[model samples]
Target: MSSSPAALSGGTVANPRSRVILASLIGTTIEFYDFYVYATAAVLVFPHLFFPPGNDATALLASFAVFGAAMVARPLGAIFFGHLGDKRGRKVTLVGALLTMGIATFLIGALPTYHQVGWLAPALLMLMRLAQGFALGGEWSGAALVATENAPAGKRAVYGTFPQLGAPLGFILANGLFLIIAAILPSDDPSRPSQAFLDWGWRIPFLFSIVMVAVGLWVRLNLVESTAFEKTVKAGKVHSLPLVSVFRTHTRQLVLGTFYMLATYVLFYLMTTFSLSYGRAAVNGALPGLGYDYTTFVLMMIIGVVFFGIFTMLSGPWADRWGRRGTLIGVTLAIIAFGLLWVPMLAGGTIGVMAWLILGFSLMGMTFGPMGALLPELFPANVRYTGSGISYNVSSILGAAVAPFIAIALWSWGGGSPFWVGLYLSAMAGLTLIALLMGTETRDVDIEA
Candidate 1:
């Protein structure tokens, strides 16, 4: 109940290291669970439920546009919450972000379909997606600060990675839940015996966020504030306007960090969202698709996501040993190679599809793992939250916000060839490689300095 920052910062946790790590991991997992469930639904259900009758391709594009709206909102969320996290404390901002994201996700589930509410349906969907993005803008940077700031000397990369694990774990849970519901619910085809999945089955996954949000809040409420932020408060060094300080003092770090993340965000949406849409459409129809069945593609994705989780864990220790910059550079090169192989590998049928997912995700893990520590380490403690959050979210706008839409457009431009998409990804990786080379090594830096 104290208004003093020091009192609030030190309110909980006797063992800050491990408890903070666990708390960060739990909060991020839940946040991303809410985030990713919408992503899956955008591809699987939103086109039918929210968009008016039109070309399936145009309908699908409309759904993805709504999905991208969240990414556009993310930077604004970052600016707002980042200031609070820097001035107040990481714990306070994180809790507020979780509540915002949870409420938005729950409302998204309860929204009426186009048939029921007409244009109001898509409009409401866009608003909710914007809310989700805004909340997520603060979530990742806060989690990274929590884990990295409390980490043992020389182990920040490994500790930071604990929060990064949430992405894969959230992906697995979101997809697994959808997979279960998809199995239980009837196919989209009315000709099938039971109810169509698009009609109501997809809502189950979105509504399920209510339970996960409760669990995340329980764990996060017990977390003590990050030690680095606590030290800043005790020293009376907290910025009154942290966003101004971030832009004034850390502009170069912000730019480099944002570009460093370009490849990871682009590849993520490409693998999960674009691939889902690509695989499920009819190959011989007016729109070109791979002609894969829905259930089979989801199952394959679940298997691939499991590997994403595994390598996400492994990437921590790997980055600790290999150096974050070195690990990212090596992995970015591999992503470039993988980008070139996308058409050939995917063209190989089911086995090839599996290979593509495994290879892409494995590389993604290696690169994404170090980002938690890397971005936070880029700036001093005074501006860590704001700098990292803005960098990460801005990259989302450039990379993920338009990735699927771009991929779809490129595919259409290429006459169904994936070459252009592959080229796009490879180009992003090239930019990331340049960013890595321009940045300094931070694994040995003092976080509180």
Candidate 2:
């Protein structure tokens, strides 16, 4: 195992491994916290608060469209931040991304609703959402590089999963906060004139991002740069234009990585964002839904996310032993099978919903775990940030950015049936399976190469 420089220099920390993992994990947790909070609000609060209160379907679609605007901005964020991350150091670019995301999220919490500011409310929300996307574009790849580059040899997959843990942890924290807020300001009845949750409860989660950002910045600012990046700089191998070099030399990796991540991105949004909308919609209405009360569904999602976190950790060691490609292939097959069974699972009511979510999240963890290592390993040290960030964020556009919007459209087109959504997911998983088959096993590769 290679012994890289510890995250804390000068001082002798007994466990440098813990420091690096925690630094990466905490920063990603903050990023996902800001990102997922907006996702939750897009489904729960934005439709009602930002859009004109008429035509439930149209309003929800508009809210989701606004939600997707950030996704559209992610690649641009990737290009900008990726260039900076490759040119400067990973640690500095990460700090900048954190600050950008934090300020945007906090401002979102303070924005006026449609009732107070009319069309201006959504307009401002759109801008904040774009900022969030830009920041997040750089966050994941940088965090992954930090963890994988610092990992002891043969343990890169395990260490890389540390950043992946943030996804489920962030999901839990984001929804858990919303769950508490919903409980505190209990809605008497949805039919009632007063809706406490829509009025003020939703803002609490977005407002709380300021606290998370502060702590993340503290942890990240104290960390040293990755040893791999330091070596590249010392060797004078740093590319003057990483984006150009990445395209010129590693275009295939970029294309392969993007498609390789398609299923993971699709599954993530479908389980977290799309399901929230599906669970809370009116069952007997023109657009049939599961008829679950808002709080009940949120609690269910929190429970499911717990399983996602556990399996995410478990997938790390499994990938290490089984090989990254093998683990991904098995998990992708499971995802395809799960998609095929979506109709029956979702139709089974509360028990079905629980089963559906738990199974979906478990698969999400398995597939998502090794990605932190897998994506970064696809590129050499010099352009790792630019290549991986652009690939991952571009995949977000093709997958997550359009997932909820696509799922909702499919559902509406299918007259509320989940079959089309299932087929869509299956198709995505199929693409990932092909990519995995074509790609090499990156578990044993040297990230600094």
Candidate 3:
């Protein structure tokens, strides 16, 4: 772990390329898995078990409210963990964040239901959700920096995608397990959850996170500090407080980076969270829905996530070849266009719905992949952790934290049509497009410099 000014001047890495990929990818995979596990349960189980047994809409909104509360805590987390990351180092900060998330998620499984503890159930739920958000706030940027900083020349974006790949992989694993559990405790009706699942089956995913967290810790513990970080240390450039430095000096980049991710966040939450509600709603509502079963809809989303994985991998090369800004601009434009297809595609039946899922997930992959490189590349190594973590998590509040709530309100107002939701997506993408246009290409930038 010793780094001299001379060794770091030449940028000597303690970790090889393979180690870089594994460390970055494994940490994020476990982190995102912990996240998606809660996300799936929030929709499928929380409303029924944790909230007061009354209005379904009220309960669901309550669940989402707690869910979005985490977004508020994320920036705080970014400040705390980002400080540790920029000053102490990425490896230790990442390990700490992962452990925090794992512990919170595991404890969530054992919490008492509303029937058992009344308001305390939801209160405790929000507390744990906030912990998850805080941990995730620092996790993504640290993982991204680890990958990109350790990358070989011209391959930063390629390596960046390794960490971004965790989103889809985690989604698949989390939901795939839920699917298996649902099978084990089959509901009498496709439309409703089995009593067994509501009572106990839902806890398994949350409780299982500790095992994955252990493996992530092992991989990350073996990682040495990256060359870029070493160089920064050798140069004595680590800031006293990266959060203050980033805000004071990097305001423009911070604003641009935050908005740049808006469309991706909006599109993502809509596709997964809102779609689950829309897909499984009654066919005879005021505007009418597709009337899918819970399992059927989740399965559809999982199928589409496969495309998300494939395209996520593909976007790496595209970003490397064409450059991160230019590539994101192209995909952001496509997202704007994709927003218009929600109504028809969703209404067209299973095939059309599948088409919508595939297309949405594909655009999601393309846009999200480059962000791993693009955000950290927005700033120098000195404040990279704070700057990137803040911008990224701040976007979560603007886009993801509110997207589902807004979309649901819009859906009801539109009489169940997804048209307004599509417009909302397009508008967010429009802002992202403007942001991308202002951003410079970072593909050839020397991140360690």
Candidate with top TM-score is: 3
Model 1: per-residue Cα lDDT over 1-449, one tens digit each? 22222332446333355567677898889888998899888877787678988667898899999999999999999999999999988888999999999999999999998999899999999999999999999999999998888787778888888899999889889888887877788565521213567777788878989898898887788776766887898888899999999898889999999999999999999988998877776787555778777778877887887777778778888878878898898889999899999889988988988999888888878888899899999998888999999999999999999999999999889877788999999999999999999988878888987
The per-candidate count of clashes, in order, stands at 0, 0, 0
As a TM-score, model 1 comes out at 0.95
Candidates ranked by lDDT: 3, 2, 1
lDDT score for candidate 3 against the true structure: 0.90
TM-score, per-candidate, Cα-based = 0.95, 0.95, 0.97
The number of residue pairs in model 2 that clash at the backbone is 0
Better of 1 and 3 by TM-score: 3
lDDT of each: 0.86, 0.88, 0.90
Best by lDDT: 3
**Candidate 2 local distance difference test against the native:** 0.88
Off by over 4 Å in 2: 1-15, 190-194
Instruction: Please tell me which model should have the higher lDDT, number 1 or number 3.
Output: 3
The C-alpha RMSD in Å for every predicted model, in order, reads 3.4, 2.6, 2.6
Q: For candidate 2, which ten residues in a row score worst on lDDT?
A: 6-15
